[model samples]
Target: MAEALADIGMIGLAVMGSNLAQNIERNGFTVAVWNRDPGRVDEFMATVGAGKKFVGAHTPEAFVNAIARPRKIMLLVKAGDATDWTIDQIKPYLEPGDIIIDGGNALYHDTIRREKALRAEGFNFIGCGVSGGEEGALWGPSLMPGGAPDAYENLRPIWEAIAAKVDDGPCVTYIGPDGAGHFVKMVHNGIEYGDMQLIAEAYDLLKRVGHLTAPELAAVFAAWNEGVLQSFLIEITSQIFRAIDPETNQPLVELILDKAGQKGTGKWTSEAALDMGVPVPTIQAAIDARVLSSMKDERVAASQVIVGPPTSPEMPDKGDFIMLVHNALYASKICSYAQGMAMLSTASRAYNWNLNLGEISRIWKGGCIIRAQFLDKIKQAYHRRADLPNLLLDPDFNQWMADAQTSWRSVVSIGALAGVPLPAMSASLAYFDSYRTARLPQNLTQAQRDFFGSHTYERIDKPEAGFVHTEWKELIQ
Candidate 1:
């Protein structure tokens, strides 16, 4: 007989949405859930929603009516057009000051546009990045919410209660205005791409060169997981190796297709880095590796005719080589993180987002795909220097890289000599070397550009002066 009131309302009753709603309810807040299809709402109410403090609504109007004033609604629908459609459907029911939170993998630029438009209509908008996928949603996920300060203040308690905790702090923070949350999330996904590819390269090297069995490789990864490489991905990778394919009676990973699939976050990050003139070669290389892997037919055909070098490099002692691969993976991971953070730094300045880099690293310690034991060091690095240009430049990371360089180089060299494509690892090493070099061969590149396109070059002799052009024909003649 009485209208049920909810602290928060969630649209899109998909796995992520439903799990997040349950998480909210578990945190002692009542949640009102609505889905595009009323059948889903009825089904959820009958199953997962039965015991939970959930208010199931069949329509947007009922969902809005069930929420308390200055309503907080989270949209976990598909990113692009579906997000826009959901907003349009609910806008008439929402009053001014009501907050709409988008928790999808949307492009940051799109988030910015939506925020601006929603604000113009007198509604508050938040582009919140929800990481760690379905499990994280059900338990606790890292939350990066960017929007109006007032809206964030209102949503803080709810988010803080539901987010994963590292030490004593929650893995949720107010990431600047407009699209900042999505931007950081995009960079996170990019770093994940590089991290995964680096791990894959290590596996390839150990299998091809060391000739280790799947179980042995799994042991190696399991060992790494106990050390600095400890993370969700590495833990899962070890488990993946140990799994047997029911159909093939082989390691699940071996039985699976060679082609890797992507959902575009990595590509979006690469494109954003290029547009911002930020160097993220490791991320780019990871994306390229996926694209190359997708051409399974071409690769198989090419393998027959292309004919790589005959002599495979001699493998080092198994024990020594394992350590080398470990060091290489760790060092390259540092470089990839460095590049991802540098891009974030650049985007912060370019977009005037005033992002807190230190806090970003802190929140990423849990409930994110890139969460690792080493992230603590990254947090400290930024805490030591808030204006840190790159993670590689930090004293701790710098010392680690200096110590790891020998083994890192060895791994890369072995891959090259053996014709094993270590694109991500190689690119990371190249990035490190290029970054440390005071002077590059760019002067020659500039000269060639000037010769062919009259692009004009800046002279080192006059560092503070304007660009200069030279007549190459007169000198050649």
Candidate 2:
């Protein structure tokens, strides 16, 4: 079986899958390719403009037979019930100990469940996250493979060379055992939501007050593409702004709805964090903003909707406001990813995943959607202290926080004044403050706790037996 079609091939021929197959082929793995529609493979061969680099299987059975021994099949298709249907289609062709990898953004819980079900038939299952979008797929993608160590070891070489490199390091690694890869990707999407929301809030500010048009805004984002603020989303956003309507010759975005669409990963990240008793305020706010944006008509009908960002708009000049928003955006994005990383850490401890955060950062460099330079810092930060609470806890990141705090407040205040929504942005700053603060005002809280449950309070200066006998004395009654 290993000799028939070579090893390390894939199924499905969507743009993402097609590009990824091409990348695998480029990286020197002989890939046996198949799509749901076998006819499309022929079309793809023509479109690829390279006959020698890629070879396609004419049918599912042919595809299954092409793979060599200790068979590994990578599934790249639409997730959920459709994925199940495809798995069923391929089942009859599989033998015991055959491997299957789901590289789509399926739910982590679903991955765990799928692995269990597949094991019943003596199959090995892996859930991996493929990132860096289409171009990355065509070249090398950040690959996060999580499941059995043997399955990961078997596929390592193909993933190793094709992933983005970080200081001579490969960007692909085993994220954890079982469902950890998908879980990390879930948190990645959540952070993406928050980062996007912050940028949008900045746009709203520049549009409403700074007097910038779409073209001008596009330029700002383009400039950001080269700076520290650069990212995949920022790059795409610049292109999106340049898109125009053929009929009206106007910016297409201007005519689109204010609402946004989401698949379920971001929502799940927030929900999972809540279930774990973790604070991910910015990510949750971003998710909420999307949900609320979708309820557009209902709010207009009510005429009772609240308006504006949470901060007041005062005590800052225009230049200060811009810098504040920018700094705040940067600081906030760090927090979002930190939360995701924290979840992975927690889940790792629980699952005995023994995931290496630095290795995870290395793997995230190129093959995935969230690939960026910041990941280098993430790798460095985690390498310095594997148990560092978050990126912000790192010395360099801490200094960044101290510098940005004043500006964040300024931007939030301005957004409130200008009637823009900075839900995610403002929330990120708040999360940072709450997370960093050693002491938060809790007298009212302590009184309530003691009143209801007799929960004792620790004195600010002391720890043992700090009673609340001065509950009224503290008020000087």
Candidate 3:
């Protein structure tokens, strides 16, 4: 009988899986890699896996056997049924207490269900959120693992070794038990959607209002990358603008279609927020923008039929408008992240996860797509007050928002006048305003509801009194 040689095993051989396997091996762990299709295993072994510390397994039984007991296996399979199918194939061979990790973008509820089922069957399951795209997977990625504490302790060495390091610390952490990791990842992606959309709006304003060419825009983004907006997405956006299209002999972004693609993670975030009664308007607007973008045919038809503003607004000083855009983007980003943080806080309490917001923000400062210079401020804010209800209430952020409010309002107004859809930015501003307002018009809505259905509402004047119904029409009569 062959001896168990591999320290850990990975079951998928797609770009993400292959890169992660190589990363593990690079960290000095002997890794066993398998693919559902044997040919892929062969191809990877010959190419990316060649001369690496990798053991190619032909079957699920062989894959399980190659790993040392109690084995640690990660699945980078498709999120839904595919993950389940892969697990079933390996379950028969897995011994008691072996850890199986779902490293894909899974729905948190599904992760919870799987973890519970696996635990009942005398196994440990971890729903780990792996972020940082193909390149990050190959080098280092931010890892969010949620499971039993013992299970995390077992995998800690490997996770910490392969995670991106920032400020002399790893970007991997043991999130709370069960689905917390995946839930955090979902919100991360949702926040990423908002970030991308906000940056896109800023780019549009730079081009249309500021009259900056692609190269100029690229330079602007590069400059922003050195400032408060320094982030992976912003840095990439600069590089993307600098790319030239060979076929069109023009800026690549200019030649490409405006439509965007999305997986269901953003929608999941919005749906979960709705279910929890948490308002994530910026993230919701980002999802809506993507959905609207998908209707390319309808949009094309509408573009021809619907008349927009008669004239485009020209910025008196392009430099000054550019600064306004920077302020607007920064302020809007604060609102977007605040909304996501609120959702996380709500989920933490509801699920009894006891999440560490500061740690989460700290780990997100590197390797993840949403990693930003701004995250350090968030970490500090949470460290100062762990139970902060909203980031807008934080002293630093409060002052920043107050200082930038005029610029943000001007940018949104200009977009409106120019007939450009700045959904995320506008929604973020509205969310901020709505949150700050002490007295809302919802009183009138409550009165209307009571008049129609006798649904009661609380009275401000009647202290200590519960909900009361008033015949509003009778008072008018």
What tens-digit string does per-residue lDDT give for candidate 2 at 1-477? 434466765888888888888877777777788888877888877787255556578877877888876778889999898779878888889899888999999888889999889988888899988777788788777778888888889888777877766665777777777888888778777777777777787788777767678898788788777877777777888898899999999999889998888888888888888877778888888888888889989968755766545664454565555566678777777877777788777777876778788777767665566666777788889989998867778987788778877877777776767676788777887788788778787767986786667675667666665574444435654
Clashes of each: 0, 18, 0
lDDT of prediction 2: 0.78
Model 1 misplacement above 4 A: none
Better of 2 and 3 by TM-score: 3
- List the candidate 3 regions with Cα displacement exceeding 4 Å: 1-4
Clash pairs, candidate 1, are none
> Which ranges of candidate 2 are over 4 A from the true structure?
1-4, 45-50, 53-55, 244-246, 302-318, 441-477
The per-residue C-alpha lDDT of model 1 at residue 412 equals: 97
TM per candidate comes to 0.98, 0.87, 0.98
lDDT of 1 by residue, 1-477 (tens): 886699999999999999999999999999999999999999999999998899999988988999998999999999999999999988999999999999999999999999999999999999999998999999999999998989999999999999999994999999999999999999999999999999999999999988989999999999999999999899999999999988888998887788999998999999999999999999999999999999999999999999786898878899999999999999999999999999999999998999999899989999998889989888899999999999988988999999999999999999999999999999999999999999999999999999999999999889788898899888995
Worst 10 residues of 1 by lDDT: 307-316
Tens digits of per-residue lDDT, candidate 3, 315-407, equal 658889889999999999999999999999999999999999999999999999999999999999999999999999999999999999999
